[model samples]
Target: MLTHLALKDFAVVQSAELAFGPGLTVISGETGAGKSLLVDALGLLSGLRADSGVVRHGASRAELVAEFSLADAQPATDWLRENALDEDGDDGRHCQVRRVVRADGGSRTWINGRPVTVGQLAELASHLVEIHGQHEHQALLSRPSQLALLDAYARNDAERRAVAEAAGRWSDLLAERERLTAQGDVSDRIGWLEHQHAELERETLDADSLAQLSIDHRRSAHAAGLLEACERAFAVMDGDEGPSITRALRQARDTLQRVAEHEPRLNEVDTMLDNAAIQLDEAAVLLDRIRGDLDLDPQALEALEQRMGRLHELARKHRVTPEQLAAKRDEIATELEALRGADERLQGLDADIAAATRAWQAAAEVLGATRRDAARRLSSDTSALIAELGMGGGAFDVVLEVLETVRPDPQGAERVEFMVAANPGQPPRPLRKVASGGELSRISLAIEVAALGLDAVPTMVFDEVDSGIGGAVADIVGQKLRALGERRQVLCVTHLPQVAAQGHAHYRVSKSASDGVTQSEVQALGAKQRQDELARMLGGVEMTREARAAARRLLSDAG
Candidate 1:
């Protein structure tokens, strides 16, 4: 339950703070006193959109903070802890949500003073509060929402989810089966795949071999030039002609040896000349070996070029890199295997889809039966309650239509709509078509009260639930709301005295103006103040003695 709400510079509410407890808390005020502004403030705390339009004049931004105690909200507490947003409080039993809207229309959110995304705030708020706008009842106009409401009332959530899962599985298998069937003939597909696989199999496309082939082809293409270059260099270095480097170095070493007897430095020079001669000889031998290894055969060169050309041609045809041809071959082979087994797989999918369809149908039947039972009771109870709220002899019904679906659907196979007839002999029609605005509100109130057993929301807020009714009928509306408050925290914003008198707590909104600036203030009324406020609501602006007495009697009877 909400323990506290604080608003800063929000709308006509310049600044306000209120502490709430579990019960029916009522907000009442005179015309244009901004009673609904309090509800709007609460709405902002529950992740509603905020903008500068809601900010007070001359203020930089609007701020809202709502505090919830987790003593009875284990689910919300667990959610906070799981999300790592429960950082400030030690016991993990307190949650504080705050939102700030700047004048530029940008907003920031926080949970337990730690910055968070607006989505996170919205998600966590679901476990904390349910803020029903005056038009939330308009959701009944949608068929999907009607179906969801029925399931909620039936309390068949587990069964409905199971049916959805089974239906999804069935739909997936059916799609797969249809795709395979569209392939026309498995025999033709397998024959095509096999032919492609055989064509790729005739050539080897290994990465390392392809690279080596390219290298060898380059060498073969220039084999004659390479051999000629090496031979020319070898002839220049070690030729039989006059004054070769080897012959000169040998003569120099002989002359140096003769002079070595006269000078020790001459011996070192002779040693260096000998080392140069040995290195030149070894280099000449390597040159000869290289010339011998060169492939000078034109046929071999032509064959290597033809092999490379074939690989390139195949690559262009397949639209892939030469190295990827191997992978493509493997892929084709796998598809061939699949086509060979297509008939077997089709049989398996058919069996699985059949089983899934049976499971879904069974669950849908059970869910439909439960809904039928719950709907009758709900419609009867809500219809009977509406008579006391000024709609005498009205009738309400839940129209559940079974549908024939080509394929299984997630929401089981039915459409639901709420129908109503206001007069005794009138035929029932769709609620949206038959009910007026005020009647919609009242009927919505009736359904909300009747479906209390199914509402898991911790808090329920009703804005002007007593919209159209008055006199003795207003009293019945108040009593029903107070009874609902007995189970969950109920907050109501109303202008009716009877409704205000029935609240466990009452707040009065009064507007004040200074310097042509208007602001709304909310005051939680004490016993005497509540009596006076109820009197004002009962007897207009006058609040005569009889009104006060009657107000006190209403409060007493409510208690």
Candidate 2:
């Protein structure tokens, strides 16, 4: 339950701290007394969008904080844990939400003093409190909200889950079928893949073979020039005209060897010259072997050229470099395999889709049946409640219409509409179109009282629920609000003294101005003070003796 609200520099409320308790808390005052400002502050703390205009004239920022005791709120506790916003080491019985809005239009929010995103704050607040007023009544007029309310009251969890599961399966199967059909329609692409595969296959190319072929092609391309160069080198090193340089070196080495006994340096020079002559003879033999090996084969050259050209052409066709051609080929092969087996896969998907459709239909039928049963009970209960609220001869009904085909949705195929007949002998019509504001409030109150146990939120606020009604009707409205308070904390902003007298706690809002600034203040009233306020409400600006007597009687009767 919401335990306390602390607001500062927010609208006309410069600073205020209000403590709340269980049961009906009524806020009553004249119009423009900032009663709605308090609600707006609570809304801001509950993660509603903040407005800079809410900041007071002199304050740079406005702060709103709400403290909720979660000792009985298991759903909210679980939600906090799930979102990792649980307080550490502290008892799990309390949660605090704080919101701050700067005068410059910037806003920040916190949960238990820890910073949190506004979205997270909103999510957490949803499980803790429900604000139902004129705005919510407008929302209830929507068909979607009508359907949801019916489902909630019906407690059709298992049926809803079954429909959800079936819908998910059907959606998955449809996606798979689409994918398989797309793949199977690519038969024309298979021919192109085959052509690419054949082109690579004819080459029979391997890394080692390609390397050797490239080497041979380069050597063969320059064979004539290479042979001529080698021949010239060999002739220079070992020509047979007067023994050439080798013979001259050998002769000089022999003469030096004979004078080695007279000079050791001469012997070293002779040894070096002999080594040079031997190296020259070895070079001539190597040159002769290289010249013999040199062969210029045009056939091999033409084959290498054709192979390179084909590689380049394939690379361009595939929009890839030659090095990536292998990877591209593997990808295409995989795609071709999928296309070839698409028919079988698509058949499997069709069977799955059929099974899913049957499952969805069965679940939807079960849900529709449950809704019909629930609608009967709900209509009887709401009709009784409406009569109790001073609406004589009013008939409330829940109209459930089933779609022709099963729709893939968790909420099933039934469309629910709240139909009502406001007066005797009048035909029932959609609640939104037929009910006046006053009638709508009464109907909403009846539905809320009926579905109180189904709701998880601990606190419910009703603003202007007594609009357009008075006398006995207002007394009945107060009775219903008081009864709702027994199950959940109800805060009603009302103008009727009868309703205010019925409150477990009463607060009176009054506006005052000083130094050209206006502000509103709320004070919780005691029994005597409540009677005085009730008298004031009965007789505006002045409380007459008869009005005080009536107010006293109203309070006594309310007790």
Task: Please name the candidate that would achieve the greatest TM-score relative to the true structure.
Answer: 1
What is the C-alpha local distance difference test score of each model?
0.83, 0.82
Candidate no. 2 TM-score = 0.67
* Alpha carbon deviation, residue 184, candidate 1 (Å): 3.8
All candidates: CA RMSD (Å): 7.3, 8.5
Tens digits of per-residue lDDT for model 2, 431-450: 87854666777787887887
lDDT of 2: 0.82
- Could you estimate the TM-score for every candidate? 0.68, 0.67
Best by lDDT: 1
Which consecutive 10 residues in model 1 have the weakest lDDT in total? Answer: 131-140
Q: Please give the range of 10 consecutive residues that has the lowest summed lDDT in model 2.
A: 131-140
**CA shift at 421, candidate 1, in angstroms?**
4.5
Clashing pairs in 2: none
